[model samples]
Target chain A: MTLKVYADRMSQPSRAVIIFCKLNGIDFEEVRVDLSKRQHLTPEFREINPMKKLPAIVDGRFKLFESHAILIYLACVFPGVADHWYPADLFKRAKIHSVLDWHHSNLRRGAATYVFNSALAPALGMPLNPEVAAEGEKLLSASLAKIESVWLKGKGRFLLGSLQPSIADLSLVCEIMQLEVVDEKDRERILGPHQRVLKWIDDTKNATQPYFDEVHSILSKVKEKLKKLQAERGVSANESIGRTTLHSKM
Target chain B: MTLKVYADRMSQPSRAVIIFCKLNGIDFEEVRVDLSKRQHLTPEFREINPMKKLPAIVDGRFKLFESHAILIYLACVFPGVADHWYPADLFKRAKIHSVLDWHHSNLRRGAATYVFNSALAPALGMPLNPEVAAEGEKLLSASLAKIESVWLKGKGRFLLGSLQPSIADLSLVCEIMQLEVVDEKDRERILGPHQRVLKWIDDTKNATQPYFDEVHSILSKVKEKLKKLQAERGVSANESIGRTTLHSKM
Candidate 1:
């Protein structure tokens, strides 16, 4: 049986997993567990991951959840995958682990929370929270700075100076991709100061190619869809959310 | 030169790293960087860890941060350490990764945020935010439920059904240890429902004895100090916090 990747494109980690499978030509089925529809909360889905989160995988009888775990598992189990994605050297692998762990608490938190409050909440008809957005933006900038000054200055195009993109590069870049849902100006303002981060994203994109773009096309559509929705709903909904996404994006 | 560990025992991750080294009998120097005095923010500390976080390690020329990464690095590098801490097997290690990654965003976030907003804030002389604390409580409960229903249900004494404790065990158990700072009643109120989780913490503590209690002695003193401070400051100090940490803890 083919490896089963249960995901929804809307989730940042889910997209990362889907793109990774495609990039490596790993034989897998994309089983959509849509978060918006509450599909992941169902009992059927719970059997795969008791946590009830997306981006889970099942290889034969063995099952796994959490994107970083899934990614690492794939890297190790799949013989066809390149060594650079998750090297055999202990130190190199540990460094990647550091980046991934930090990304979870720092990058993912800041990017996702900020995007959800600033953009997606209103578009999805949920209450907008400027307070959370502000806090997330502060964290977001700090994480970007860390990426630029500390992680991405490596000799290689990837994080920790690796010549090839590791799972860390893929995980973090996908997190930044969530910013695409925000208006063009906010996206620029948030990511602008970190030139290294921007270039590294581009480099990672180039490295993975067609799959990266193909996987992220869903996000671009969601952005356009959200802007059109906010434009239709008009002022009242966007008022609670400062920096309304509609006028700026449209 | 001995491996140098820069840490403050008050920080959860820092204590985990310290305890792990002692438990394994790895030679190291404990270089304290106190968080309360903002010592971690100093330029000298930044040289050790660019993120300015606790529990960084400098092994001769190699400097590393993020406790999970440091744990993995240590397990792989140190020959004296046992295999179960971070086994050589690909599958066993990947499962451990899942727990550690989940612990970061879910367990660590909920535990630390709740402890800070609910109990630690007023004790340390910061303003209370009941709204954030309530949200943290909800996340904390959900995380504990996951721990009970999912991770700890394994056949063995540790998570993932491992007969021996892994780094995942150390990292998470240390995170749960932060709850000690909260008033005893609230700790029971929050952790009471999750029987398996409580037992697992005990099991993990047993797996890494002496060092666990030795490292946590600082937290015990802090708990006492906070109680005395709150009592001395009087009721008005605890008024804003709805739960009122004084009566139950004392």
Candidate 2:
């Protein structure tokens, strides 16, 4: 039986899972669970994942959730895929696992909250909570700094210096990519200091190819909409009024 | 060179790693970093883990942080260890991974935050924010409910129906063990509803043996102190005054 992946591309981890399946040419069915519409919270979806999370998978009688776990499972089950993605070497795999585990409270929290406050909240017609936005920005900056100084500090193009990208690379880079949907100035402010991290993001994008772009199309559209709103407002991208106008539009 | 694990008994994940090492009989050195004294923040220790989190390890030249990652690395590197702790079976391992990953945001968050606000913050002489404490209780209760209804609903003594406890069981059980440090009334309210979760905790403790008790000795002391305080106050264990008296002692 073919693997079934339940995902919503808007979520960073979901995108990572979808991109992984697509990149490896794994035979799978992509089932979209729309988060914006709150589809994941429904009883039916809850049955698949009682946690009611996305990026879950079902292969015959077996079912799994948590994107990193799903990725590891795929890596182990699909022998056709290269080992570099989730290396078999004990030390190397452990290092990758370290990055994956750390990503949750650090990068994922920072990036996710930042994008939600700076971009998503406003777009969804909710007033931005200044305290949350400020906190989010602080977290985002710290996460970016860590990525620059720590994870991406190594000589390799990817995290952990692997020639090929691992699941950690996909998971983290997708998280950072959400910054694109934020206002240009906010994005630059949060992501600007990390030159190496920026390079790593580009490298990951290039390596993942067309599927990367495909999975990220919604974010690109969001970015474009924000840009057009700014243009219509006749205000600079960094100006507070531009954001206000965008908020009004929503 | 022997593996060097930097940990603190007070921290849940640190206890998880220490217990895993002791339980598996891995020859390693335990380097305690006293978190209450802010020892982990020292520049020297930060060299070992730039993230500055406890439960880091230095295995010769390869350094790793994050307890779950360390456990996986240990399971893989130590060939003689029993496989059920981190099974080689594809589906079984993935389910374990699923539990490990789900733990951080759910069980770990709820239990850690609940203990921090209700017990640690006050013990550290910090004022308790009632709002945060209430929120923590809600989260803790919800997390426990999920554990009983979802993770522990299976027939086996451990998660995933394994006859033997996996690292997920240790990681989660250690997290829940934090509740013991909380006030008696609050602890019962939060933990009382979930019989299965309670059973699983006992099962996990029994399975791991002396190491589980050794790692959790500090918590035991805290619990004993609270019980004594309750007795001295001439208040029932469920009474609010008992906690206030305990707070004064701390």
Report DockQ per prediction, comma-separated: 0.76, 0.74
Off by over 4 Å in 1: A235-250, B122-124, B235-250
C-alpha lDDT score of every prediction, in listed order: 0.89, 0.85
Residues B1-250, model 2: lDDT tens digits = 9999999898899999999989888999999898878899999999999999989999999999999999999998976779988988888899988989988877787777667766677445575566777777787788788877887766799987778999999999998888878777877887788888889999999999999998899998867775565464456535667778889999
Stretch of 10 with least lDDT, candidate 2 chain A: A229-238
Q: Please tell me what DockQ candidate 2 reaches.
A: 0.74
Say which candidate scores most in DockQ.
1
B38-94 per-residue lDDT for model 1 (tens digits): 899999999999999998999988888999999999988987999999998988888
Q: How many residue pairs clash in each candidate?
A: 1, 0
Residue lDDT tens for model 1, A133-232: 9999999999999898998785778899888899999999999999999989999998888888999999999999899999899888899899787787
TM-score of every model versus the real structure: 0.92, 0.89
